[model samples]
Target chain A: MNAVKAIFLKELRVEFRNKQMINSYLILSLMIIASFRFAFSIIDFSITELASPILWISFFFGGMFSLSPIYKREIEQGTKEGLLLTPISPSSIYFGKLFANLFIIFCLELFILLLFFVFFPVNIPDLFSLLCIIVISTIGITALGNLISAISSNLSQSEVMLPVLLVPVLLFTVIMSSVSVTSNVFAGANIFDVLDEVRLILAFDVVFIAVGYLLIDYILEE
Target chain B: MLKNKLRILVSILAIIFILISVYFALIYTPPHEIMGDVQRIFYFHVASAWISYLAFGVTFFAGVMYLKSKDFKWDNIAFSSAEIGILFCTLGIITGSLWARPIWGVFWRWEDIKLFITFVLWLIFIAYLALRANAKSRTSKANLSAVFGIIGLICIPFSFGANRIWQQYHPTILVSSEGSLQPSMALSLIISVIAFTFLYIYILLVRVDIEKMKEEIDKLKQKVGG
Candidate 1:
């Protein structure tokens, strides 16, 4: 537990100091918002309906882009080995990395969602439900991303391979997130409407996290 | 020697079965009232999907075998199976698109759960093969690939369920709310299933044998060098 916190805080500090992850995420989100705004200005469609899908798209691709630096940076500095040699369990290391990545992506997602709402006239009937969906879907994304990024960091083409390996597996998360958000936007945040999507995301997150934890020790074995 | 003989036997039988299946698919199976000629593609398309599933199942089994035995042979089998699975899955997706063009009036739609999931499956295995190619050591490559093979197999169910849960338009193909298949199409599908399973087994055996021969040649080369 202490090791998990230590690693988690260590990663958070590194991420904060470097600011690469947050900078890229913010830039990409702004670009997506700008593109959509430009396109919508020409074509007359209700921005409210499009808000959820656009927000999810930004988050999904942005989260994917953020994965390279998470593990690749550690591997490049040879810090991964040093961290592994510590008394921390591999699962703790896995979870800590996962949690940190999730936090970064979740924060990015929330910011994008806020930006989308400001730009568009989307009204959330239930803020709590939307937050739940966001957190659950983000877990699913980061859990799988953590595992694949760990694998990719060791590969020659970590940059390209992470997305190539991840996008497919994480498609489920992306689809579910899109569906949940879309339903919330169009249908007034009915719990029943988004229940299946939320459940699927939650179930997938749990399963992948468990699998990633069990396999991380072997994956990190020298 | 016996194994070689058996391989030959299987190959011959597979060839015969495939020829018979194609004949049945083209000439014997009556055209559907709605889908017409395009429906014929379903025989091959569905067969390829079956073959893909069978290949992945072998991959999953061989993955476990490699982990348990730590033998290079099982790893070879797993790799060969994944290769075969990817081929069949590709064929499946292409045929499905061809079928969809006439029926759905669109060749590809991301909303279709099955099509999307199948594409993802294809990409996952392709990544697995890429990982294998880039690894530095043989043992490390095999071990890593085996782990990936198992993890990818485990992911299939979630992928499938996710698609289904989203209420997408992709045909479930295997069970219906009302009940079983629609008789004629079901029979034709079953025959195609058998034919494709035979094809899968034949291809797998040939690939495994080729891998074994390559290993033997590598051993000979090492012996000469030493």
Candidate 2:
């Protein structure tokens, strides 16, 4: 736990110091949300009808931006081996990075959700339930995102490879279920009303977290 | 010599079964009462879908074995199976679209869970192959793509159950208790499936052999360069 905490803090400190990833995330989120808002307005579809897909698309794009740096920076800085040499287990490194990425993603998602509501003006009856859904859905995204970023970081073109690798795996299961639940919430359905989708997202998070934890060592193998 | 003979036998058998299956599907089976001749696409569509799933399943198993044993042979098997899986998956999607155009009056339906899930599966494996191409080292390629192969396997359940789960407009042809498939249609479907399975095995055998040969050539190049 301490090791996980230390790594997590180190990640936070680095991000806080440079703010490179967070700044990119903010700009990227804004661009996605703005472009989407314009696109929807041109189409003249009810923003309320299309709110969830647009929101999740922004999250997905911004989340991908944040995740790419998870391990790519360590590798580029030639610090991955040094981090591995530490007494900390590989799973600690994974969880620490996952938690760090989750923190960043969660913040970005809340900001995007706020921006979404401001631009689209969709109503939600239960804010807390929506927040819960966002947290769970983001967990599912980052849990797999961090691990996949670790994998893609080993490749020559990590940036290009990250989305290509991440999108399809998440689209049908995590992203789809998240969109479903979020749309339900936006449609005035409570958390219980969308329990099935929420449960699917939860299961996706658990399965990928377990897979990532068990397999991180292999991906990190020298 | 015996391996060569077995390969030829399997190849010939696959060809013969496929021809027979086509005849059964096109000529032997009665035309659908409602849809008529275009329904023949069903046998091939379902068969391709079956082979694609089986190929991915094999790839997943080979990936686990590669990770467990750290054997490049298993890596080769996984790569070969994934390639074949993508091919058959593409065939399945195209056939499905062709069937959908006349019947559903649209080439594709985004709202349909089964079609969307299958397309997603296709996208995931294409990414798998792309990752394989971009990887720098043989070991890294094996290790990383093996992990990816396992991750990709999760799509199988959602693909298989998409029609059932969402109750989408995608037809539940074979599995329904009321038996939508007549006896002749069932025979044709079975034959088509067996033929496609044989073709998968034959292609897999050839693909694995080619992969092994490529590894050997790489080893020789490294030896000579050193």
DockQ, all candidates in order: 0.38, 0.57
Alpha-carbon TM-score of each model against the true structure: 0.87, 0.94
Displacement of the residue A27 alpha carbon in candidate 2, Å = 1.8
Clash pairs detected, candidate 1 = none
lDDT tens digits, residues A17-114, model 2? 88665787788888888898788776667655688788888889988988888798899899998998888889999999999888878888888988
Worst 10 residues of 2 chain B by lDDT: B169-178
CAPRI tier for the interface of model 1: acceptable
In order, the Cα lDDT scores of the candidates are: 0.77, 0.85
iRMSD of all candidate structures: 2.5, 2.6
The recovered share of true contacts, given per candidate in order, is 0.30, 0.54
Name the best candidate (by DockQ): 2
Each candidate's B-chain TM-score, in sequence, is: 0.89, 0.89
Predictions in order: chain A TM-score: 0.89, 0.97
